[model samples]
Target: MKADVMPKPQNMFQAYMLLFLISSGQIGVGIFGFQRIVGMHSDHDAWISVIVAGIVSHIVVGLMFWILSKHESADLYGIHQHLFGRWIGNGLSMVMMVYYVMVSVTIVRTYIELIQSWIFPTFPTWVLSMTLLLLAWYGITGGIRLIAGLSTISFFVILFFIGTLYISPIKYASWSHLLPIGETSPWAIMKGTISMGLTISGFESIFYIYPYIKDKSNGAKYAQYSLLFSNIIYLFMMIMGIVYFSKGQLTRSIWASTSMLKIVKFPFLERLEYIASSVWMFVVIPGLMIYIWVLGRGFKRMMGWKQRMMTPIICFVIFIGSLISQDREHIHMLSTFTGRCALFVVFLYPVVLFLFQTLILGIRDQSDKKGAAE
Candidate 1:
């Protein structure tokens, strides 16, 4: 007997959800302590680096949209295959799959470390990692629409959480700490911008997310908006960190944003950082979900595996991998290396891919017109 053939068309998300997805994805575990990363290079002028990184993220987002708009129906995987041959494209896709998995792993591990250091000193990494991964697994299996809705909700939770920044702790901030803004050298500031850019790197999700947008033409506009929004948040946080902590203090702060919350006092709330840190699980989960979902999607397309099946296997691997490093120093090394790798992949690869793809498309268009004329 012949099988029935009417599969439901995949539902696409509205343009505004792009804002939530991109913003939430961008504002992950990185922002919890990004001030120190940038501070290491630019000192108190890290906010300048934050602004520069914002501008740079906008430019990169533009490049990505330009490349993607040229092929609205195709995702990055499809574009890669079209631009390169089948084998080479598949190879690149596998590498990207691994990259996405690594991103999820980094986020999960880093967040667990944050929780362990602050909330539960004796918690096992595998247990927390498994819990977070299981949450991600459930979401990934639910489809992109569910993920987008959760992100939208997470975005509001984060916005409300930002109110905590305005409480008593901020009074301790000395705007004087940010005096002489240009004291750092240009090279140092640029290095700091690189650090900020890594924190802002989740905008690359646009490539995978492009095909799922309902209003494809308006997608870039919302994407640019989301990048700008993420930057503003980063800049605000960086500025606040600089004002609140001296360069010496900031360098010592493992989680600068969380540390800032420690000074907050209210009749009802005793330890604000704990509250903020717990709330941050919402902030970090979207990034993890996006990466995990994309990992499942990538493997499904490449290997004919079901995304539901791939989800558990990926989470298991991530759980096992998270167990390897228990030392704070080792975790730092892993995170640092991942951030640099992400910087190269997120910033440089898109520019290179755009140029090469554009040139190839232009030549093909010219040849097609010439053939038509003949």
Candidate 2:
């Protein structure tokens, strides 16, 4: 199965780091305006969609660990090979590599778009792209341990920024806007659940990071906590968005989370959204670092390429791609495509794997018992 090609286990991350890493990954780009998109279909009942999606995410995380628990030391590539044989498995792994790369690109570019639209209309895209990519490049080269530490930083820093919502957005909210909930049809709520699925897709990073956990048995628990935390944050933000903006205003605002900052005027400070925007870089950086690192790690696993070399090249490609995709429409298309792809990769794929593994084990156990009886 070419398992020997996988790097020898080195120092591993602790259980807590799993919480930080998974949370950091899931909480990015999507959280800002996820309410609007999900709301478009489900409307005020969108928070219901968030809750349902969170439950689904918890289930998916459990299934991921079920699969990983069966093959304790293997990553997704190894699991694929075990289930599908060498050629098909490697091909699937290749596709995952491409998905990871696209994730990194979409995230970095979207953040860049946010910057250009909100804070710096005249700023050159390439400059911001290059600068962010360089920082990500440096972090990825330090390997997963450094990346985990970065996630820890992102988690705490983001909390303070999240606290800002309490100051302004909550005051503007009308709880009546969220009333008449459950008024949406089941089909509509399910559609919103699907949208929330995309927003919460980053938990799939666990597939790549699983083998590195120091306490493998506790891995699933920490992952569930991470997903739980993300769900809470997402739900809170979506509710705030619903109440603060009228139905029309909520749907129209692209970055509703940041838009909440406009009401956050202080005696000494003005343009609080700008302050929130600046702090968002911290929130965004961890996701970019982890996804980019995953892309590099995927290359290392499949082709035996050095992650150090692969990272900068991937970053360069993302930079050039960002430069080319300055149009808002183009950026939106990229995000939509990535979101759809992630729904399959992150949510559905693991369930299929877990079922296949369970069936195979059952059949093998029957054969063994029959042989022993003979």
Candidate 3:
């Protein structure tokens, strides 16, 4: 931790705890919809795009940590002030505030959509929203420690889903279908990588968790590696998605993962997807809670509140926003726009911070050396 950074909530998580929170934030509902998006473009090459996108995000997230690791402690808001003057930093901070809110709202809508599609149709949307909001408020109010504890459990469940792919042999996977990487062009693949990158977008929450880590000195190392873990896990999922979906079968399907499971049969279990997807809340719940917690943290920072004053207000706002989902198209539009906005903070913000910090440090070092020589 940098000398300048203050421990907020006056307590920090162990390295392992921090790692769990970051990874949980990375893993989410993306896995469920991933195969559908991957099948839209190239065949097996979807896996290639997955690797490419993961590498790109990995590099960008590394730069994010490099900028934060330079100062004793700088939240995104603090980094804005460090790089930009007060006015510009203030402006950028507001942009981040909007980004976090949009993210949480979009996720809230998605959660509702999933519940309506899979579990509950007759349940009033408001009732589902309120229940989710209640559960999230409890977790977010407890702070990062609770988030980490929940994530550790979710991580194990998510791993079992990834491992389930192993039960079906890849020898059945057809290669003639996957032979052509780019029947169209490299441009198409790039476009797919950019679009489907949403599946892996959860890694950005490290910005919120940096100050919460017990060891700041090696926090970047831990973050980068945790992201690395996320990348590899995601990559494996993509490969399994491609191989499992096949080529022709994927072309005609709506949700490739759902359709792919149509072949799965056992004496005891008829629909593996039903049972499998039931545990899926493991991924969705923790993911929604994390973004909500980050939203709460932002409120806490801006309001300058005692613990008592801050959390309730934050939870109330999130609960209210959960009612914003009128339909699927609306939620999709919100998610799409928010994801595009996230690109600025995720991809562009760190580069700007790195350049500004480097330039300022160089100037300060020169001034120090000149003064000593005089």
Q: lDDT of each model, Cα atoms only?
A: 0.83, 0.83, 0.69
lDDT of 3 by residue, 90-193 (tens): 68777877676666666666766665776667768777667766787777667778878899888788677767744563545655655666574666667667
What clash count goes with each model?
Answer: 0, 0, 5
Using TM-score as the measure, what is the rank order of every candidate, best first? Answer: 1, 2, 3
How far is 228's C-alpha from truth in model 2 (Å)? 0.7
Residues 201-291 of candidate 1: C-alpha lDDT, one tens digit per residue: 8878888877778777888899888888888888888988898888898999999888888877778988888888888888888788888
RMSD of each: 3.3, 2.0, 3.0
Q: At residue 18, what lDDT does model 3 achieve?
A: 53
Question: 89-178 in candidate 2: lDDT tens per residue?
Answer: 889888887888788888888888888889999998888999899988888878888888988888887677786555667876789998
Indicate the worst ten consecutive residues by lDDT in candidate 3.
1-10
Clash count for candidate 2 is 0
Which residue pairs show backbone clashes in model 3? 1-216, 1-217, 2-72, 3-72, 5-73
Q: Identify the runs in model 2 with alpha carbons over 4 angstroms from their true place.
A: 1-10, 361-374
Predicted candidate 2, C-alpha RMSD: 2.0
